[model samples]
Target: MDNAGSNQDKGNGKYAGKFPKIAQQTRLLNILVIFAVIYTLYLAKSLLVPLFFSAFVALLLSPLVAFARKLFIPRTLSAGALIVLLVAPFTFLGIELAEPAERWMQSLPKIAAEISKEIEEISSNIDAYATPPAEPVEKERSFFSWFGDDEKSPELSPPQDNTNSVTDKIKQSGIDIGLTLFGNAPFLLAQVLACIVLIFFLLVFGPNLFNVFVRDFPIVTNKRRTLVLVDQIQRELSSYIVTISIINSCLGLATAGVFYYLGIDDALLWGALVALMNFVPYLGGVASCVVLLVVGLVQFGLTSSAFLPAGLFLVLNIIESQLITPAVLGRSMQLNPLIIIIWIAITGWLWGVVGVLLAVPILMCFKIILENLGVFDHWIRLLESK
Candidate 1:
């Protein structure tokens, strides 16, 4: 027994000596894996962005689809119907806003010119009041002046027509943009079609698909765990999406009312724009403010009243973000503000605008998975807001 104990101790000691090295290797491997995953996401964004969006849409509509199925509706028919219903509002909104949006686009150059004029006026006013620096007197040089080296100087070219150059450049830019859009139109259409199709399939088959996934798990324990995890994720995501949608809708209405009260043209358009932008958290809020500010400046000029719309929106946003959102979402959905910002930045860097939009949902997903796995407790704590 003593000899057996001694051998056991020897075996442990040998492993203990190698343990640190193994741990270092594991950590290195984890970092490499993370980098590889990020690179893969970046490269596949054209494919994955639509997939992620479709997944979210599927999650949001799956409950409705399931309910419809319970009433004896065919799952495939229900899925297709829901997808059409989902897109209908956006189509209607576009049709409604098209004229106003086009009008605004047409007026942009005039607005820009007005803004430039105001800036120039302000600069001229400042210059008028300020003392000008004295001009340096030029020293006349002789033909033989060695220090000036007049003979070595190149002959002056005729002044170029900057206006024509500018116009040509603008035309060229327009043509290039037109060509680029024309080139990508088919691909964009394909992606949209792909997303719609994927959403339909997911809505129709998502539950059965997940069940099959769980069934394929090697261990019964794993299967059960996965089932629970998937169920929880679906429930939580659906709840979050629905609640947020209602809140954004309400916010949009309020914004429209505010804009109308302020006599802002295209109030409904601005409201819709704000509502869509609000999905992106901090960045969205900032964008809304800038849009309101520009609209205010364009409509009301550079006076103090020009800030009214933006300031009011700022106040409304603060109330909504701090009070209404937290109350509606509850503590369970609360994420660490710092983590949220970092996640948004990382995802934005990885996948541009789509990444920024998907960041919160993806982070929530990871948080839920980690929680269910019963690991990374500290990391979960870090993810959860105070």
Candidate 2:
């Protein structure tokens, strides 16, 4: 009877020790699940990106929807208004871009000719400045010899340059670009579908989606706190998108005006490019300036005045960036510029243009959520505590 009692006590002790081990295993399993989920997302990124875009747009439209609802507008009408307001402008821009882009494409051959001419001029200028290596003059004093020239009937010395010719370089560049654009079409189609679907769902059920998240988390028992966090996330996302669009639009209009003032034929095209680039933060400004410079160089000859259009673009950007944008987004996008640039580049790599544009809103949403969480809240402090 004593030995049996001892065995029973030992069994109870062993069972108690197993709980911590079981808990550890469970924790490991959870971590693995998280990693697998992330991997799965990466693999399905094609499907995810467009849906993500729609989700963001839907969030962006929520405040407008809410305001309309408050004004006694029906939900369907409000949704339609938001969709039209959002989608119509893009469609119009697409149409507008088509003509300019086509013209630009048509102008490529002329541009190529101009480039070649400029290159030849540059080579001539360089040669003019350089002392030519003196070739030994073979004095051939035949009756048919040049009146004062000692130049031999130059047997075409086997073509002096083995380096890729300029034409080859141009053709290679075009082919490489064509191949890349071709490769991405499938992903692009997926993204478009995802955005439309996500946006539709968001407009129809954005409110319910938030509620479901709050109410249905398996272990996150704090429903109200989660709801508040989710609400803040939506607000921040919407604020970013709306603010970015308005600022970019204003910048675009101003840029177009500057180009018009400069007598550029495609002012609207340049402006649209500037506006689109502005969505990309730091990198966009430099890229727009470079493109404008090239356009200037192409439209005008390589004379002293060839850079004026580019200069105009620079001036406009300086005014818009240093004066206007700062005042508008000063308090809002207080995230670190360097970090934002990095995130944009990474997302842009994974998902391309839309990803780059969406990076800011996504970051804002993340910062908002992290602010509400416990340890991850430091990102908020570092990003937004300004």
Candidate 3:
């Protein structure tokens, strides 16, 4: 009897131990399933990128189709006309900007040389103001020096003398310029194709498709609310794009005027660049300023003169951020600066400029979806009240 009791007790202990092992296995299985799903998504990531962009473009261009239909044109015909209209304007702008941009690129070397000299003068002026940096430094190497020749890739190292290695310069510049132009090319090409394909389909058949997609959605009292949410998102994003375009164009014009007055070469190019780039958030403005400063230095052979363009930028940036945007855009759709910066960095890191460009809209889409699902309503309410 005692032996039987002992065996029973041992069996119970073993079973309890097995239960924990089973739970652990279950947890691991769940984790693996999640990872598997992520991996699958990663594989299909290529397809998703283009389709996502196409959907966004479709959303933006939807109103035009609706307007065309209102004018008594067939919806399909309206969409086709709108697409051609968009393409023509887009191409025309590119062609107009090309020659000036080429001229600016060719003159970059001279501007860089100018900036190096002005930096030294600025240091002296700072000393005169009694606000000198703790470290006495002079002759900050111009940005152009960082890009080494093709024979050797520039090695990135902090130059003791404050001049970055030419190799380091090349690498960093490539990241800033090349990836956006080239890395995104494949995705952009795919996106363009998808847009062309979908635009016609949507124009001819969007009504049916939208109806089908919505048919199986949860039949709840909130269907109307859900639709309103979608309409609100579409309007907000479209308005945002239009507003941003206007603001950027103004900034570009202002940049051109300022630089031309300062006798900067290729001022028109710089202005156009500024206007176009400012469409992006923090990075856009900062990059244009950097490029402008560089161009000024190369052109004027001094960084002090770079200030004329820089000053214009500062004034315009402030106007846009404080007066223009706020007065126009208001606060309802405003995003948190902290989140914006972080997401920009993350998206830029993961997928480069294309990622950064899409980040805000992507987040906004997610926010709207969450709101529709009631997942973010509480948070949004808190945000609004505060």
Residues 1-386, candidate 3, lDDT per residue (tens digit)? Answer: 99999999999997988998899999999999988975664566566556666677777888788788788999777878878887887678778877776565544444444444456566557656875335533445578856846444444443335443553555455445544555666867667767688766766687566655565656544666756776787777777767767877887888788778877777777777787777567777788777766555455554477566666787788788778876877776567766777877866665555566777778667666666567758766543342
Off by over 4 Å in 3: 1-45, 104-197, 216-228, 381-386
* Candidate 1: tens digits of C-alpha lDDT, residues 70-176: 99999998998988898899889989998887777656656655665666666667865784554454455666675663455433444433232444454455456
Residue pairs with backbone atoms closer than 3 Å in model 1 (clashes) = none
Provide the TM-score for each candidate, comma-separated. 0.82, 0.77, 0.68
On lDDT, who's better, 1 or 2? 1
| Alpha-carbon deviation at 259 in model 1, angstroms | 0.9
Where model 1 places Cα greater than 4 Å from the true spot, the runs are 1-17, 127-189, 217-221
Error of 2 at 261 (Å): 2.4
Best by lDDT: 1
Residues 143-169 of candidate 2 have per-residue lDDT tens digits of 766475655564433434423268556
Clash count for candidate 1 is: 0
Better of 2 and 3 by lDDT: 2
Best TM-score goes to which candidate? 1
The better-scoring model by lDDT among 1 and 3 is 1
Cα error of candidate 3 at position 345, Å: 2.1
Ranking 2 against 3 by TM-score, winner:
2
Local distance difference test values of all predictions, in order: 0.82, 0.76, 0.69
Where is model 2 poorest over a 10-residue stretch in terms of lDDT? 155-164
